[model samples]
Target: MTSAVDVVVVGGGQAGLAAGHHLRRQGLDFVILDADAAPGGSWQHMWDSLHLFSPAEHSSLPGRLMPAQPGEAYPDAGHVVDYLADYEKRYNLSVQHGTRVDAVRRNAGQLMVEADTGTWRARAVISATGTWSRPFLPATPGREVFTGRQLHTVNYRSPADFAGQRVIVVGGGNSGAQIAADLTLDGHVNVTWVTQRPPRFLPDDIDGRALFDVATARRRALEEGRSDTGGVASLGDIVAVPPVRSARDAGLLSVRPMFTRLTADGVRWDDGSHSGADAVVWCTGFRPALAHLAPLNLRGPRGHIPTDGTRVLGEPHLHLLGYGDWTGPASATLIGVGRPAREAAHQIARQLST
Candidate 1:
């Protein structure tokens, strides 16, 4: 069946859902096409012990409120999934489930979305699939021989799943630190954290959005050929909560220099050292899935979709949410995507209406 809609939301997570809510309120004819069997995307697959670093008030939807029962301690990963499921029901959002989008193409007037189940055409499209769609694994020599459970943090459930096992976590991102911490303290699993740069952990009292907001202002000034964020400081220049010290003080966890190469019994590092472990978790970051959209004509050399602060660059009918922008931090957390999403929706709606 050839179905035409106002918009085809490619992702079903918070960003897509938020865009849907706005489109519905605008009374626009729209259909959200989700690749997942249900909503909550990554949150549905996150580590079970995951929680929003931001508070409940920070986790609100477009027109709804987060339940206070899971108040304040930051909603766990499971809690977030339940909230998203509930959000879908509460908004009565329209969704076509398990319809994996194979590739999206474009023609003269409209965007064509081809899925495994069917094809959908939309006047406009919002690519809300955050960078987490695929895990980024760097190429290291002898990596294929690691005779342990090597998993990306994307599929990580909990440290308990690796309890009583030796685990080595790669990458220095926030997720890597958090997962390594969990595995060591909560699950009693041995851990060896490998990363090129040491991580800086933010305190529970501070959030990435607040820091990004400050950085954004600075970026804006620089973009306009000005200096400074009009006194607003960058994340590094601004207040820092000392995440590394916080994590170590929080508990005793083992950390190591990055893995220079991989081995069968263990991994080797640049400083002529080797360690054996039972599991390897790659917490390295992600890249955009623009390869399939061969015709989109978007993206920068750094493997990022070019955008005007919040809107996609040169692509009028297309906007990418959760990409690092001057308007917000590139953290890609639920806390950051909301603003970009709302802004993108308003822009798309205004143009479509005209």
Candidate 2:
């Protein structure tokens, strides 16, 4: 059977939940379609030791605050998952779980979302499907032939999984740094960190909270016709979370330049040095999940949908939430995502109402 709504949100994570909050406040008929069987979105899949760089207060959705668990300074992945589940119930947002949207296409001036279970015909569609599902591994030569246990951050569960295994963690981002630290600190595995460029650590005081504030300022600056924030930091850089800090203090954190190529057992550096490792953990990040929207023919060669803010350039009835900085600066974060989501909801509500 086909369902219909005024708007259909394509994800149920923080982004979709944020959008749902505004859509509810706007009193619009909307339904959130979540691919996962449960409420946590991608957080549930994160490594067990993963914690937000910011405190619970800094990581929150639109209408609710993330309450910290007892004695926990920074919220862990499970905390986030529980909070997300609670957020949905607290707001009474309409969500259909396990509804993986296979494609979104224009149908008679409305967008039709084709999912695994059924179809949703809506006046407007908000594509909040974030990048977690689409992990990107750099095209390194011999990677196809490397006969080791290759895994990405998405599939990574815990350091115990790699116990006593010589592992190479690739990428300079937070995931790369954090996993490397986790493995090294546990003293169970040898981890070699690799990045294309040297990793930059934000100031000790600078956490995800500060980054959100900076992103907000930058977004506000652009909106108010200002060009710069006097030098806003790139959100892509790593934040010094507690474990990461501990790793640094213990002198366990070290990095290497990107490898020339992969070998059967390990990687080969440009200087002809070879490092043999048992497993390679790719924290190389992800591309935007725009495959469902491909039917709209909006994706560019870079696999991104060009947007004037959150709205697609030519497709006025479609808006993309979450994803990444291209949608809005730091729009993927729990705190930073609300701005674009609210904006998108407002825009869609206005369009549907009129």
Candidate 3:
């Protein structure tokens, strides 16, 4: 049997929650599908030291402001999780947790979502599953022979997990930087990082179109569109971090070049080898997870649901809020998603009305 609904939202994270909020304001009948036991998605796995680089003012979602002291620091992963928990409760969003959506198919003009719990029938499907749904790990020649412990950044949370363990942090993104910094906080273990290029290392609070350009470059490269936002807009988006300078000045962690290849035991670099690590933290970042949605045949070569202006081009009822910032500035952040949410909701409402 198929359970009927006006809108079936997949993934109950920030994007799903924001989508739900907008749909509610429009008075649409909807339900959120989530595989996790709770609302927080990636934040549930983020390290203890992880915080938003975009700052509190920019990190907020729609309909609510991130509560922070004046000129205060940004919220970390846990803060984001807790905020989502509160957001759901405040708005009374309907969500089905512990429900895994295995496939989505059309049956008699209705979208049928097959999951572990049962079948869900809906007028439309909104995928709040962000690009980070799939964590990307490059396959190495001797991965099986490697004796060192290997883990993705998605599973790594807090330096306590890496305490007393020599760690090799991989990748040069902001997440990698934060993980490396936290690992060296107590000098408990020797930390070595391998990356392709030094991160541009901009100040944590810098805003404006520089951010949008960087985001668009990444989006265009990944999903074939330009993202509109501040922070992380282009290769120029990378800059020297104030913390890097302060950390170097204060004698904390050190940065290095990219990881070249993997040997039987650890990773090797073109520059040289920085050995002495029992574990490798791959902060290489995530890919969009829509393998189950393959029947739709809408994904690109990179395995993401490619879109035009964030709208899943061929699929009219399908839409993505975080797909390269189709709106103006700040649409990718927690607060920024609000504008897109409204636009997407209005679009959905229009389809329903007609």
Identify the leading candidate in terms of lDDT.
2
Candidate 3 Cα errors over 4 Å, as ranges: 54-57, 69-72, 204-231, 235-245, 251-253, 271-274, 300-304, 324-332
TM for every model, in the order presented, reads: 0.87, 0.96, 0.85
User: Candidate 2 overall Cα lDDT vs. reference?
Assistant: 0.89
Ranking by TM-score: 2, 1, 3
Model 3's alpha-carbon lDDT is 0.71
Q: Which model, 2 or 3, shows the larger TM-score?
A: 2
Q: Write the per-residue lDDT of candidate 2 for residues 1-354, one digit (tens) a residue.
A: 898999999999999999999999889999999999999899989998999988998899887889987878998999999999999998999999998999999989999999999999999999898989999988889999888999999988888898888899998989999998999999988889989999888888888878877877887898799887842355447888989999988889989998998899888999998989899999999988878888899867665568899999879999988877789888899988988888998998888878
Residue pairs in clash, model 1: 201-243
lDDT head-to-head 1 vs 2, winner: 2
TM-score of 1: 0.87
After aligning candidate 3 to the native by TM-score, how far in Å is the CA of 188 from where it should be?
1.0
The Cα local distance difference test for each model comes to 0.70, 0.89, 0.71
